[model samples]
Target: MSAAFFSRDIVSLPPSSPGMRIGLFGGSFNPPHEGHRLVSRECLKRLDLDAVWWLVTPGNPLKDHSDLAPLDARVRAARALVAGPRCHITGFEAAHGFTYTFETLSHLQKTLPGRRFVWIMGADSLAGFHHWERWDEIFSMMPVAVYVRPGSTRKAAVSRAASRFRHGRIDESDARLLATLDPPAWVFLHGLMSTLSSSQLRSRK
Candidate 1:
Protein backbone atom coordinates (compact mmCIF):
# COMPACT_ATOMS: atom_id res chain seq x y z
CA MET A 1 0.00 0.00 0.00
CA SER A 2 1.17 3.52 -0.77
CA ALA A 3 1.79 5.98 2.05
CA ALA A 4 -0.93 8.30 0.71
CA PHE A 5 -3.52 5.54 0.60
CA PHE A 6 -2.57 4.50 4.14
CA SER A 7 -3.74 7.93 5.32
CA ARG A 8 -7.44 7.04 5.14
CA ASP A 9 -9.31 5.92 8.29
CA ILE A 10 -9.97 2.80 6.31
CA VAL A 11 -6.54 1.40 5.66
CA SER A 12 -5.37 1.03 2.05
CA LEU A 13 -8.54 2.54 0.59
CA PRO A 14 -8.45 4.99 -2.30
CA PRO A 15 -9.56 8.58 -1.77
CA SER A 16 -13.13 9.49 -2.66
CA SER A 17 -14.99 12.71 -1.86
CA PRO A 18 -18.39 14.33 -1.82
CA GLY A 19 -20.46 14.20 -5.03
CA MET A 20 -18.28 11.47 -6.53
CA ARG A 21 -20.25 8.61 -8.04
CA ILE A 22 -18.79 5.47 -6.45
CA GLY A 23 -20.07 1.96 -7.01
CA LEU A 24 -19.51 -0.52 -4.19
CA PHE A 25 -19.03 -4.10 -5.38
CA GLY A 26 -18.56 -6.36 -2.37
CA GLY A 27 -17.62 -10.04 -2.46
CA SER A 28 -15.18 -12.71 -1.40
CA PHE A 29 -13.12 -12.39 -4.61
CA ASN A 30 -11.49 -15.69 -3.83
CA PRO A 31 -9.88 -15.45 -7.23
CA PRO A 32 -11.19 -12.29 -8.85
CA HIS A 33 -11.30 -12.82 -12.60
CA GLU A 34 -12.42 -11.25 -15.85
CA GLY A 35 -16.08 -11.68 -14.95
CA HIS A 36 -15.73 -9.23 -12.06
CA ARG A 37 -14.01 -6.75 -14.36
CA LEU A 38 -16.73 -7.22 -16.99
CA VAL A 39 -19.38 -6.09 -14.51
CA SER A 40 -17.23 -3.19 -13.34
CA ARG A 41 -16.75 -2.02 -16.88
CA GLU A 42 -20.49 -2.11 -17.52
CA CYS A 43 -21.20 -0.29 -14.28
CA LEU A 44 -18.68 2.43 -15.11
CA LYS A 45 -20.00 3.07 -18.59
CA ARG A 46 -23.73 2.62 -18.06
CA LEU A 47 -23.97 4.10 -14.58
CA ASP A 48 -21.58 6.96 -15.40
CA LEU A 49 -19.69 6.17 -12.25
CA ASP A 50 -16.51 7.95 -11.20
CA ALA A 51 -15.13 4.80 -9.61
CA VAL A 52 -15.95 1.24 -8.57
CA TRP A 53 -14.55 -0.12 -5.33
CA TRP A 54 -14.23 -3.87 -4.93
CA LEU A 55 -14.91 -4.55 -1.25
CA VAL A 56 -13.04 -7.81 -0.76
CA THR A 57 -14.82 -9.31 2.21
CA PRO A 58 -13.08 -11.40 4.85
CA GLY A 59 -15.71 -14.08 4.71
CA ASN A 60 -19.30 -14.63 3.74
CA PRO A 61 -21.71 -15.33 6.57
CA LEU A 62 -23.79 -17.62 4.42
CA LYS A 63 -21.03 -19.44 2.57
CA ASP A 64 -18.99 -22.43 3.54
CA HIS A 65 -15.39 -21.39 4.23
CA SER A 66 -13.72 -24.75 4.00
CA ASP A 67 -12.26 -24.04 0.57
CA LEU A 68 -12.00 -20.27 0.73
CA ALA A 69 -8.64 -18.67 0.13
CA PRO A 70 -6.92 -16.23 2.47
CA LEU A 71 -8.07 -12.62 2.29
CA ASP A 72 -4.64 -11.34 1.32
CA ALA A 73 -4.34 -13.92 -1.44
CA ARG A 74 -7.77 -13.02 -2.78
CA VAL A 75 -6.90 -9.33 -2.74
CA ARG A 76 -3.67 -10.04 -4.59
CA ALA A 77 -5.53 -12.03 -7.24
CA ALA A 78 -8.08 -9.24 -7.67
CA ARG A 79 -5.30 -6.67 -7.95
CA ALA A 80 -3.82 -8.63 -10.83
CA LEU A 81 -6.90 -8.08 -12.98
CA VAL A 82 -7.06 -5.12 -15.39
CA ALA A 83 -9.22 -2.18 -14.33
CA GLY A 84 -9.87 1.33 -15.49
CA PRO A 85 -8.31 4.35 -13.80
CA ARG A 86 -11.26 4.73 -11.45
CA CYS A 87 -11.67 1.13 -10.39
CA HIS A 88 -10.13 0.04 -7.03
CA ILE A 89 -9.67 -3.03 -4.85
CA THR A 90 -9.80 -2.80 -1.07
CA GLY A 91 -9.97 -4.96 2.03
CA PHE A 92 -11.76 -2.27 4.01
CA GLU A 93 -14.43 -4.49 5.49
CA ALA A 94 -11.80 -6.70 7.05
CA ALA A 95 -9.54 -3.77 7.90
CA HIS A 96 -12.37 -1.97 9.66
CA GLY A 97 -14.10 -5.09 10.99
CA PHE A 98 -17.57 -4.97 9.44
CA THR A 99 -19.52 -8.23 9.09
CA TYR A 100 -22.77 -7.36 7.37
CA THR A 101 -23.61 -5.44 4.19
CA PHE A 102 -25.76 -2.88 5.99
CA GLU A 103 -23.13 -2.30 8.65
CA THR A 104 -20.38 -2.06 6.08
CA LEU A 105 -22.22 0.57 4.05
CA SER A 106 -23.18 2.49 7.18
CA HIS A 107 -19.57 2.61 8.31
CA LEU A 108 -18.34 3.70 4.89
CA GLN A 109 -20.97 6.47 4.76
CA LYS A 110 -19.80 7.76 8.14
CA THR A 111 -16.15 7.62 7.18
CA LEU A 112 -16.64 9.04 3.73
CA PRO A 113 -19.52 11.43 4.12
CA GLY A 114 -21.42 13.31 1.40
CA ARG A 115 -20.55 10.87 -1.37
CA ARG A 116 -23.04 8.99 -3.58
CA PHE A 117 -22.70 5.23 -3.08
CA VAL A 118 -24.32 2.63 -5.30
CA TRP A 119 -24.52 -1.01 -4.31
CA ILE A 120 -23.56 -3.10 -7.34
CA MET A 121 -24.52 -6.74 -7.62
CA GLY A 122 -25.41 -9.45 -10.12
CA ALA A 123 -28.98 -10.65 -10.56
CA ASP A 124 -27.87 -13.99 -9.17
CA SER A 125 -27.42 -12.35 -5.80
CA LEU A 126 -30.91 -10.84 -5.88
CA ALA A 127 -32.45 -14.29 -6.17
CA GLY A 128 -31.04 -15.07 -2.72
CA PHE A 129 -30.75 -11.55 -1.26
CA HIS A 130 -33.60 -12.26 1.11
CA HIS A 131 -31.26 -14.56 2.99
CA TRP A 132 -28.74 -11.84 3.76
CA GLU A 133 -28.56 -10.23 7.17
CA ARG A 134 -30.46 -6.93 7.34
CA TRP A 135 -30.90 -7.13 3.57
CA ASP A 136 -33.81 -4.69 3.41
CA GLU A 137 -31.81 -2.06 5.26
CA ILE A 138 -29.19 -2.35 2.51
CA PHE A 139 -31.82 -1.39 -0.08
CA SER A 140 -32.87 1.61 2.02
CA MET A 141 -29.29 2.76 2.58
CA MET A 142 -28.13 3.43 -0.96
CA PRO A 143 -29.02 3.20 -4.62
CA VAL A 144 -28.52 -0.26 -6.09
CA ALA A 145 -27.75 -1.41 -9.63
CA VAL A 146 -28.13 -5.09 -10.43
CA TYR A 147 -27.01 -6.42 -13.78
CA VAL A 148 -28.45 -9.51 -15.39
CA ARG A 149 -26.34 -12.63 -15.00
CA PRO A 150 -26.16 -15.68 -17.24
CA GLY A 151 -28.91 -17.65 -15.47
CA SER A 152 -30.38 -15.35 -12.87
CA THR A 153 -32.36 -12.59 -14.61
CA ARG A 154 -35.94 -13.79 -14.27
CA LYS A 155 -35.44 -15.14 -10.80
CA ALA A 156 -33.84 -11.90 -9.62
CA ALA A 157 -36.54 -9.60 -11.04
CA VAL A 158 -39.12 -11.67 -9.19
CA SER A 159 -37.10 -11.85 -5.98
CA ARG A 160 -38.35 -10.73 -2.58
CA ALA A 161 -36.38 -7.48 -2.65
CA ALA A 162 -37.42 -6.92 -6.23
CA SER A 163 -41.09 -7.44 -5.38
CA ARG A 164 -41.09 -5.44 -2.13
CA PHE A 165 -39.33 -2.53 -3.75
CA ARG A 166 -41.09 -2.85 -7.07
CA HIS A 167 -42.29 0.73 -6.88
CA GLY A 168 -38.69 1.82 -6.30
CA ARG A 169 -37.41 0.18 -9.44
CA ILE A 170 -36.20 2.58 -12.07
CA ASP A 171 -36.18 2.05 -15.82
CA GLU A 172 -32.92 0.94 -17.43
CA SER A 173 -32.90 4.00 -19.70
CA ASP A 174 -32.74 6.17 -16.57
CA ALA A 175 -29.78 4.31 -15.07
CA ARG A 176 -27.59 7.38 -15.21
CA LEU A 177 -29.83 8.98 -12.57
CA LEU A 178 -29.24 6.35 -9.90
CA ALA A 179 -26.24 7.94 -8.10
CA THR A 180 -28.19 11.04 -7.18
CA LEU A 181 -31.41 9.26 -6.26
CA ASP A 182 -32.46 8.56 -2.68
CA PRO A 183 -32.44 5.23 -0.89
CA PRO A 184 -34.66 2.28 -1.78
CA ALA A 185 -33.96 3.23 -5.39
CA TRP A 186 -32.49 0.62 -7.76
CA VAL A 187 -32.35 -0.40 -11.39
CA PHE A 188 -32.04 -3.68 -13.23
CA LEU A 189 -29.62 -3.58 -16.12
CA HIS A 190 -29.43 -6.07 -18.98
CA GLY A 191 -26.34 -6.73 -21.04
CA LEU A 192 -23.16 -8.87 -21.34
CA MET A 193 -22.41 -11.31 -18.55
CA SER A 194 -19.83 -13.96 -17.59
CA THR A 195 -20.59 -17.51 -16.50
CA LEU A 196 -17.85 -17.36 -13.86
CA SER A 197 -17.83 -17.23 -10.07
CA SER A 198 -15.47 -18.00 -7.17
CA SER A 199 -17.29 -21.20 -6.29
CA GLN A 200 -17.31 -22.30 -9.90
CA LEU A 201 -13.63 -21.52 -10.27
CA ARG A 202 -12.71 -23.32 -7.10
CA SER A 203 -14.64 -26.43 -8.05
CA ARG A 204 -12.54 -26.79 -11.17
CA LYS A 205 -9.41 -27.35 -9.10
Candidate 2:
Protein backbone atom coordinates (compact mmCIF):
# COMPACT_ATOMS: atom_id res chain seq x y z
CA MET A 1 0.00 0.00 0.00
CA SER A 2 1.20 3.51 -0.74
CA ALA A 3 1.09 6.55 1.48
CA ALA A 4 -1.54 8.00 -0.85
CA PHE A 5 -4.05 5.47 0.42
CA PHE A 6 -3.59 6.72 3.98
CA SER A 7 -3.74 10.34 2.85
CA ARG A 8 -7.23 9.68 1.60
CA ASP A 9 -8.61 8.65 4.96
CA ILE A 10 -6.23 9.83 7.63
CA VAL A 11 -7.92 9.03 10.92
CA SER A 12 -7.75 11.32 13.88
CA LEU A 13 -6.31 9.70 16.99
CA PRO A 14 -8.42 9.51 20.13
CA PRO A 15 -8.18 12.47 22.44
CA SER A 16 -5.42 12.17 25.03
CA SER A 17 -4.51 14.26 28.00
CA PRO A 18 -1.50 14.38 30.26
CA GLY A 19 -1.35 11.55 32.81
CA MET A 20 -4.02 9.54 30.97
CA ARG A 21 -3.40 5.82 30.59
CA ILE A 22 -3.62 4.78 26.93
CA GLY A 23 -3.14 1.52 25.06
CA LEU A 24 -1.47 1.40 21.66
CA PHE A 25 -2.83 -1.49 19.58
CA GLY A 26 -1.02 -1.38 16.26
CA GLY A 27 -1.70 -3.79 13.38
CA SER A 28 -2.38 -4.01 9.69
CA PHE A 29 -6.06 -4.58 10.51
CA ASN A 30 -6.57 -5.65 6.91
CA PRO A 31 -10.06 -6.57 8.01
CA PRO A 32 -11.00 -5.68 11.53
CA HIS A 33 -13.12 -8.25 13.36
CA GLU A 34 -14.69 -8.96 16.71
CA GLY A 35 -11.39 -10.26 18.06
CA HIS A 36 -9.79 -6.84 17.70
CA ARG A 37 -12.66 -5.32 19.63
CA LEU A 38 -12.31 -7.97 22.31
CA VAL A 39 -8.62 -7.14 22.82
CA SER A 40 -9.37 -3.43 23.06
CA ARG A 41 -12.13 -3.91 25.60
CA GLU A 42 -10.02 -6.26 27.68
CA CYS A 43 -7.14 -3.78 27.72
CA LEU A 44 -9.43 -0.92 28.68
CA LYS A 45 -10.75 -2.88 31.67
CA ARG A 46 -7.59 -4.71 32.68
CA LEU A 47 -5.10 -1.90 32.17
CA ASP A 48 -7.38 0.90 33.27
CA LEU A 49 -6.66 2.64 29.99
CA ASP A 50 -8.33 5.90 29.18
CA ALA A 51 -8.38 4.99 25.47
CA VAL A 52 -7.23 2.35 22.96
CA TRP A 53 -5.71 3.33 19.63
CA TRP A 54 -6.20 0.93 16.76
CA LEU A 55 -3.29 1.75 14.47
CA VAL A 56 -4.19 0.69 10.95
CA THR A 57 -0.85 0.18 9.27
CA PRO A 58 -0.16 0.16 5.55
CA GLY A 59 1.48 -3.24 5.71
CA ASN A 60 3.32 -5.72 7.88
CA PRO A 61 6.95 -6.39 6.96
CA LEU A 62 6.79 -9.87 8.48
CA LYS A 63 3.84 -10.98 6.35
CA ASP A 64 3.19 -11.41 2.64
CA HIS A 65 1.34 -8.37 1.42
CA SER A 66 0.35 -9.72 -2.00
CA ASP A 67 -3.29 -9.78 -0.89
CA LEU A 68 -3.26 -6.93 1.63
CA ALA A 69 -6.18 -4.55 1.50
CA PRO A 70 -5.96 -0.83 0.84
CA LEU A 71 -5.08 1.32 3.82
CA ASP A 72 -8.15 3.55 3.50
CA ALA A 73 -10.50 0.58 3.24
CA ARG A 74 -8.99 -1.12 6.27
CA VAL A 75 -9.12 2.10 8.29
CA ARG A 76 -12.79 2.57 7.41
CA ALA A 77 -13.63 -0.98 8.40
CA ALA A 78 -11.82 -0.56 11.71
CA ARG A 79 -13.68 2.66 12.46
CA ALA A 80 -17.04 0.96 11.84
CA LEU A 81 -16.31 -2.15 13.90
CA VAL A 82 -14.49 -0.57 16.85
CA ALA A 83 -17.25 1.76 18.03
CA GLY A 84 -16.65 3.32 21.43
CA PRO A 85 -16.00 6.72 22.89
CA ARG A 86 -12.66 5.44 24.13
CA CYS A 87 -11.74 3.46 21.00
CA HIS A 88 -9.96 5.17 18.09
CA ILE A 89 -8.63 4.23 14.65
CA THR A 90 -5.66 5.81 12.87
CA GLY A 91 -3.55 5.13 9.77
CA PHE A 92 -0.68 7.28 10.99
CA GLU A 93 1.82 4.54 10.37
CA ALA A 94 1.14 4.80 6.67
CA ALA A 95 0.90 8.55 6.78
CA HIS A 96 4.36 8.77 8.30
CA GLY A 97 5.87 5.84 6.37
CA PHE A 98 6.80 3.83 9.46
CA THR A 99 7.62 0.28 8.33
CA TYR A 100 8.49 -1.13 11.75
CA THR A 101 6.75 -1.39 15.11
CA PHE A 102 9.66 0.19 16.96
CA GLU A 103 9.63 3.33 14.85
CA THR A 104 5.93 3.98 15.39
CA LEU A 105 6.16 3.26 19.11
CA SER A 106 9.27 5.40 19.52
CA HIS A 107 7.46 8.27 17.87
CA LEU A 108 4.51 7.87 20.22
CA GLN A 109 6.69 7.96 23.31
CA LYS A 110 8.57 11.00 22.05
CA THR A 111 5.47 12.99 21.11
CA LEU A 112 3.22 11.89 23.95
CA PRO A 113 5.68 11.94 26.80
CA GLY A 114 3.08 12.89 29.39
CA ARG A 115 0.76 9.97 28.64
CA ARG A 116 1.19 6.56 30.19
CA PHE A 117 1.08 4.23 27.18
CA VAL A 118 1.04 0.46 27.19
CA TRP A 119 1.64 -1.78 24.20
CA ILE A 120 -1.30 -4.18 23.76
CA MET A 121 -1.23 -7.42 21.81
CA GLY A 122 -2.92 -10.83 21.73
CA ALA A 123 -1.21 -14.09 22.63
CA ASP A 124 -0.97 -14.91 18.94
CA SER A 125 1.24 -11.89 18.38
CA LEU A 126 3.34 -12.66 21.41
CA ALA A 127 4.07 -16.12 20.04
CA GLY A 128 5.93 -14.48 17.14
CA PHE A 129 6.97 -11.33 18.94
CA HIS A 130 10.65 -12.19 18.99
CA HIS A 131 10.63 -11.92 15.22
CA TRP A 132 9.58 -8.31 15.46
CA GLU A 133 12.15 -5.57 15.01
CA ARG A 134 13.66 -4.29 18.27
CA TRP A 135 11.30 -6.61 20.15
CA ASP A 136 13.17 -6.38 23.43
CA GLU A 137 13.52 -2.64 23.29
CA ILE A 138 9.73 -2.42 23.14
CA PHE A 139 9.60 -3.73 26.70
CA SER A 140 12.18 -1.20 27.82
CA MET A 141 10.28 1.67 26.18
CA MET A 142 6.93 1.04 27.85
CA PRO A 143 4.80 -1.54 29.58
CA VAL A 144 3.05 -4.36 27.71
CA ALA A 145 -0.27 -6.20 28.09
CA VAL A 146 -0.91 -9.50 26.38
CA TYR A 147 -4.44 -10.89 26.20
CA VAL A 148 -5.13 -14.55 25.70
CA ARG A 149 -6.15 -15.68 22.24
CA PRO A 150 -7.97 -18.95 21.82
CA GLY A 151 -5.43 -21.80 21.46
CA SER A 152 -2.38 -19.53 21.54
CA THR A 153 -1.73 -19.27 25.27
CA ARG A 154 0.68 -22.19 25.50
CA LYS A 155 2.78 -21.13 22.54
CA ALA A 156 2.97 -17.54 23.66
CA ALA A 157 3.84 -18.41 27.22
CA VAL A 158 6.78 -20.52 26.09
CA SER A 159 7.94 -18.27 23.28
CA ARG A 160 11.47 -16.89 23.28
CA ALA A 161 10.37 -13.34 24.04
CA ALA A 162 8.28 -14.56 26.95
CA SER A 163 11.15 -16.64 28.32
CA ARG A 164 13.54 -13.72 28.05
CA PHE A 165 11.18 -11.37 29.82
CA ARG A 166 9.68 -13.83 32.26
CA HIS A 167 11.12 -11.97 35.21
CA GLY A 168 9.33 -8.81 34.11
CA ARG A 169 5.93 -10.50 34.08
CA ILE A 170 3.47 -9.36 36.70
CA ASP A 171 0.58 -11.28 38.20
CA GLU A 172 -2.74 -10.86 36.46
CA SER A 173 -4.11 -9.42 39.71
CA ASP A 174 -1.85 -6.41 39.12
CA ALA A 175 -3.19 -5.75 35.62
CA ARG A 176 -4.87 -2.46 36.44
CA LEU A 177 -1.57 -1.02 37.62
CA LEU A 178 0.47 -2.12 34.59
CA ALA A 179 0.40 1.24 32.82
CA THR A 180 1.65 3.03 35.89
CA LEU A 181 4.59 0.67 36.37
CA ASP A 182 8.09 1.24 34.97
CA PRO A 183 9.67 -0.28 31.88
CA PRO A 184 9.99 -4.05 31.27
CA ALA A 185 6.65 -4.64 33.01
CA TRP A 186 3.90 -6.79 31.52
CA VAL A 187 0.83 -8.83 32.45
CA PHE A 188 -0.85 -11.78 30.84
CA LEU A 189 -4.59 -11.39 30.99
CA HIS A 190 -6.67 -14.58 30.98
CA GLY A 191 -10.32 -15.26 30.22
CA LEU A 192 -12.60 -14.24 27.31
CA MET A 193 -10.49 -15.51 24.46
CA SER A 194 -11.46 -14.89 20.82
CA THR A 195 -10.87 -17.33 17.96
CA LEU A 196 -11.59 -14.83 15.24
CA SER A 197 -8.73 -13.58 13.05
CA SER A 198 -8.35 -11.56 9.86
CA SER A 199 -6.62 -14.36 8.00
CA GLN A 200 -9.42 -16.78 8.88
CA LEU A 201 -12.01 -14.32 7.68
CA ARG A 202 -10.15 -13.76 4.42
CA SER A 203 -9.67 -17.46 3.78
CA ARG A 204 -13.40 -17.97 4.26
CA LYS A 205 -14.11 -15.20 1.80
Candidate 3:
Protein backbone atom coordinates (compact mmCIF):
# COMPACT_ATOMS: atom_id res chain seq x y z
CA MET A 1 0.00 0.00 0.00
CA SER A 2 1.54 3.28 -1.07
CA ALA A 3 0.61 6.94 -0.62
CA ALA A 4 -0.56 7.18 -4.21
CA PHE A 5 -3.30 4.60 -3.68
CA PHE A 6 -4.54 5.97 -0.36
CA SER A 7 -5.50 9.48 -1.40
CA ARG A 8 -9.26 10.21 -1.34
CA ASP A 9 -11.54 11.33 -4.14
CA ILE A 10 -12.68 14.50 -2.45
CA VAL A 11 -13.84 16.25 -5.62
CA SER A 12 -16.23 13.51 -6.67
CA LEU A 13 -17.77 13.16 -3.20
CA PRO A 14 -20.92 15.13 -2.58
CA PRO A 15 -20.56 18.36 -0.69
CA SER A 16 -21.56 18.44 2.96
CA SER A 17 -25.06 19.69 3.60
CA PRO A 18 -25.61 23.20 4.87
CA GLY A 19 -25.65 23.36 8.70
CA MET A 20 -23.96 19.98 8.89
CA ARG A 21 -21.73 19.74 11.93
CA ILE A 22 -18.71 17.56 11.32
CA GLY A 23 -15.80 16.45 13.47
CA LEU A 24 -12.34 16.13 11.97
CA PHE A 25 -10.30 13.43 13.69
CA GLY A 26 -6.96 13.16 11.90
CA GLY A 27 -4.17 10.72 12.66
CA SER A 28 -1.97 8.03 11.23
CA PHE A 29 -4.49 5.27 12.03
CA ASN A 30 -1.56 2.91 11.69
CA PRO A 31 -4.26 0.46 12.59
CA PRO A 32 -7.55 1.87 13.70
CA HIS A 33 -9.08 0.39 16.86
CA GLU A 34 -12.01 0.64 19.25
CA GLY A 35 -10.49 3.68 20.89
CA HIS A 36 -10.85 5.62 17.65
CA ARG A 37 -14.48 4.64 17.35
CA LEU A 38 -15.17 5.36 21.02
CA VAL A 39 -13.75 8.86 20.76
CA SER A 40 -15.68 9.64 17.56
CA ARG A 41 -18.91 8.18 18.91
CA GLU A 42 -18.56 10.15 22.10
CA CYS A 43 -17.94 13.33 20.13
CA LEU A 44 -20.99 12.70 17.98
CA LYS A 45 -23.13 12.14 21.07
CA ARG A 46 -21.77 15.01 23.11
CA LEU A 47 -21.02 17.55 20.37
CA ASP A 48 -24.07 16.90 18.21
CA LEU A 49 -21.93 16.35 15.13
CA ASP A 50 -23.61 14.96 12.01
CA ALA A 51 -20.52 12.91 11.17
CA VAL A 52 -16.92 12.28 12.17
CA TRP A 53 -14.28 12.17 9.48
CA TRP A 54 -11.27 10.00 10.18
CA LEU A 55 -8.62 11.92 8.20
CA VAL A 56 -6.00 9.22 8.09
CA THR A 57 -2.63 10.92 7.52
CA PRO A 58 0.13 9.44 5.42
CA GLY A 59 2.26 9.78 8.54
CA ASN A 60 2.63 12.06 11.52
CA PRO A 61 5.30 14.74 11.36
CA LEU A 62 6.16 14.30 15.02
CA LYS A 63 6.42 10.54 14.87
CA ASP A 64 9.18 8.41 13.39
CA HIS A 65 8.34 7.81 9.71
CA SER A 66 10.13 4.47 9.56
CA ASP A 67 7.55 2.78 11.79
CA LEU A 68 4.51 3.96 9.83
CA ALA A 69 2.55 1.36 7.91
CA PRO A 70 1.77 1.95 4.23
CA LEU A 71 -1.00 4.54 3.72
CA ASP A 72 -3.26 2.14 1.75
CA ALA A 73 -3.03 -0.59 4.39
CA ARG A 74 -3.75 1.91 7.13
CA VAL A 75 -6.75 3.24 5.18
CA ARG A 76 -8.13 -0.28 4.69
CA ALA A 77 -7.67 -1.12 8.35
CA ALA A 78 -9.28 2.14 9.38
CA ARG A 79 -12.25 1.56 7.08
CA ALA A 80 -12.69 -1.90 8.57
CA LEU A 81 -12.65 -0.61 12.15
CA VAL A 82 -14.83 2.48 11.70
CA ALA A 83 -17.66 0.72 9.89
CA GLY A 84 -20.54 3.14 10.29
CA PRO A 85 -22.50 5.63 8.24
CA ARG A 86 -21.60 8.56 10.46
CA CYS A 87 -17.96 7.69 10.69
CA HIS A 88 -16.07 8.39 7.44
CA ILE A 89 -12.60 6.94 6.99
CA THR A 90 -10.79 9.09 4.42
CA GLY A 91 -7.33 9.75 3.11
CA PHE A 92 -8.46 13.15 1.85
CA GLU A 93 -5.65 15.02 3.51
CA ALA A 94 -3.07 12.70 2.02
CA ALA A 95 -4.67 13.11 -1.37
CA HIS A 96 -4.60 16.88 -1.11
CA GLY A 97 -0.88 16.76 -0.22
CA PHE A 98 -1.43 18.11 3.27
CA THR A 99 0.82 16.44 5.84
CA TYR A 100 0.12 18.48 8.94
CA THR A 101 -3.10 18.56 10.94
CA PHE A 102 -3.27 22.35 11.06
CA GLU A 103 -2.94 22.59 7.28
CA THR A 104 -5.62 19.96 6.73
CA LEU A 105 -8.07 21.77 8.98
CA SER A 106 -7.39 25.02 7.15
CA HIS A 107 -7.97 23.38 3.79
CA LEU A 108 -11.20 21.76 4.96
CA GLN A 109 -12.45 25.03 6.38
CA LYS A 110 -11.97 26.70 3.03
CA THR A 111 -13.28 23.78 0.96
CA LEU A 112 -16.42 23.39 3.05
CA PRO A 113 -17.04 26.89 4.23
CA GLY A 114 -20.75 26.42 4.83
CA ARG A 115 -20.45 23.45 7.15
CA ARG A 116 -19.51 23.58 10.80
CA PHE A 117 -16.30 21.77 11.71
CA VAL A 118 -14.95 20.87 15.10
CA TRP A 119 -11.45 19.61 15.69
CA ILE A 120 -11.46 16.39 17.72
CA MET A 121 -8.38 15.25 19.63
CA GLY A 122 -7.34 13.18 22.63
CA ALA A 123 -6.14 14.62 25.93
CA ASP A 124 -2.60 13.45 25.27
CA SER A 125 -2.52 15.32 21.95
CA LEU A 126 -3.84 18.43 23.63
CA ALA A 127 -1.03 18.29 26.13
CA GLY A 128 1.54 18.23 23.36
CA PHE A 129 -0.33 20.39 20.86
CA HIS A 130 2.12 23.26 21.11
CA HIS A 131 4.63 21.10 19.31
CA TRP A 132 2.38 20.92 16.28
CA GLU A 133 3.02 23.29 13.39
CA ARG A 134 0.95 26.49 13.57
CA TRP A 135 -1.06 25.01 16.43
CA ASP A 136 -2.36 28.38 17.56
CA GLU A 137 -3.84 28.96 14.12
CA ILE A 138 -5.92 25.83 14.62
CA PHE A 139 -7.56 27.28 17.71
CA SER A 140 -8.40 30.40 15.76
CA MET A 141 -9.90 28.36 12.90
CA MET A 142 -12.38 26.21 14.82
CA PRO A 143 -13.48 24.94 18.20
CA VAL A 144 -11.58 21.95 19.55
CA ALA A 145 -13.25 19.14 21.44
CA VAL A 146 -10.85 17.21 23.61
CA TYR A 147 -11.82 13.70 24.60
CA VAL A 148 -10.50 12.80 28.01
CA ARG A 149 -8.38 9.68 27.80
CA PRO A 150 -7.30 7.97 31.02
CA GLY A 151 -4.21 9.46 32.75
CA SER A 152 -4.13 12.55 30.54
CA THR A 153 -6.84 14.84 31.93
CA ARG A 154 -4.93 16.64 34.65
CA LYS A 155 -1.73 16.97 32.68
CA ALA A 156 -3.54 18.13 29.57
CA ALA A 157 -5.43 20.80 31.48
CA VAL A 158 -2.17 22.11 32.85
CA SER A 159 -0.60 22.27 29.42
CA ARG A 160 0.53 25.53 27.79
CA ALA A 161 -2.36 25.92 25.34
CA ALA A 162 -4.94 25.13 28.03
CA SER A 163 -3.38 27.63 30.36
CA ARG A 164 -2.93 30.27 27.69
CA PHE A 165 -6.51 29.94 26.62
CA ARG A 166 -8.07 29.16 29.97
CA HIS A 167 -11.05 31.31 29.07
CA GLY A 168 -11.84 29.00 26.16
CA ARG A 169 -12.85 25.98 28.22
CA ILE A 170 -16.58 25.40 28.09
CA ASP A 171 -18.78 23.31 30.36
CA GLU A 172 -19.79 19.83 29.24
CA SER A 173 -23.36 21.05 28.91
CA ASP A 174 -22.21 23.66 26.40
CA ALA A 175 -20.12 21.23 24.36
CA ARG A 176 -22.83 20.66 21.80
CA LEU A 177 -22.68 24.36 20.96
CA LEU A 178 -19.03 24.14 20.04
CA ALA A 179 -19.52 24.10 16.25
CA THR A 180 -21.38 27.39 16.37
CA LEU A 181 -19.06 29.13 18.76
CA ASP A 182 -16.08 31.25 17.81
CA PRO A 183 -12.61 29.84 17.43
CA PRO A 184 -10.53 29.09 20.58
CA ALA A 185 -13.65 27.73 22.31
CA TRP A 186 -13.12 24.16 23.47
CA VAL A 187 -14.35 21.54 25.96
CA PHE A 188 -12.92 18.53 27.69
CA LEU A 189 -15.36 15.66 27.38
CA HIS A 190 -15.21 12.76 29.80
CA GLY A 191 -16.37 9.68 27.94
CA LEU A 192 -15.88 5.91 27.83
CA MET A 193 -12.14 5.41 27.83
CA SER A 194 -10.26 2.71 25.96
CA THR A 195 -6.77 1.49 26.87
CA LEU A 196 -5.95 0.38 23.35
CA SER A 197 -3.22 2.29 21.48
CA SER A 198 -1.72 1.94 18.02
CA SER A 199 1.78 1.94 19.44
CA GLN A 200 1.03 -1.04 21.65
CA LEU A 201 -0.71 -2.85 18.83
CA ARG A 202 2.21 -2.30 16.49
CA SER A 203 4.70 -3.57 19.07
CA ARG A 204 2.83 -6.87 19.28
CA LYS A 205 3.21 -7.39 15.54
Predicted model with the maximum lDDT: 2
Assess candidate 3 and give its TM-score to the true structure.
Answer: 0.93
Ranking by TM-score: 2, 3, 1
Per-residue lDDT tens digits for candidate 1, residues 114-178, read 99999999999999999999899999999999988998998998899999999899999999999
Clashing residue pairs in candidate 1 are none
Tens-digit lDDT track of model 3 for 149-177: 88899999999889877898899899889
Better of 1 and 2 by lDDT: 2
Candidate 2 lDDT tens digits, 60-156: 9999998898788888899899777999898888767889989999998898779999999988899999999999999888999998988889999
How many angstroms is residue 74 displaced in model 3 relative to the true structure, after the best TM-score fit? 1.0
lDDT of each: 0.87, 0.88, 0.84
- Candidate 2 wrong stretches, greater than 4 Å: 8-11
Model 2 reaches what TM-score against the true structure?
0.95
Report the candidate with higher lDDT, 2 versus 3: 2
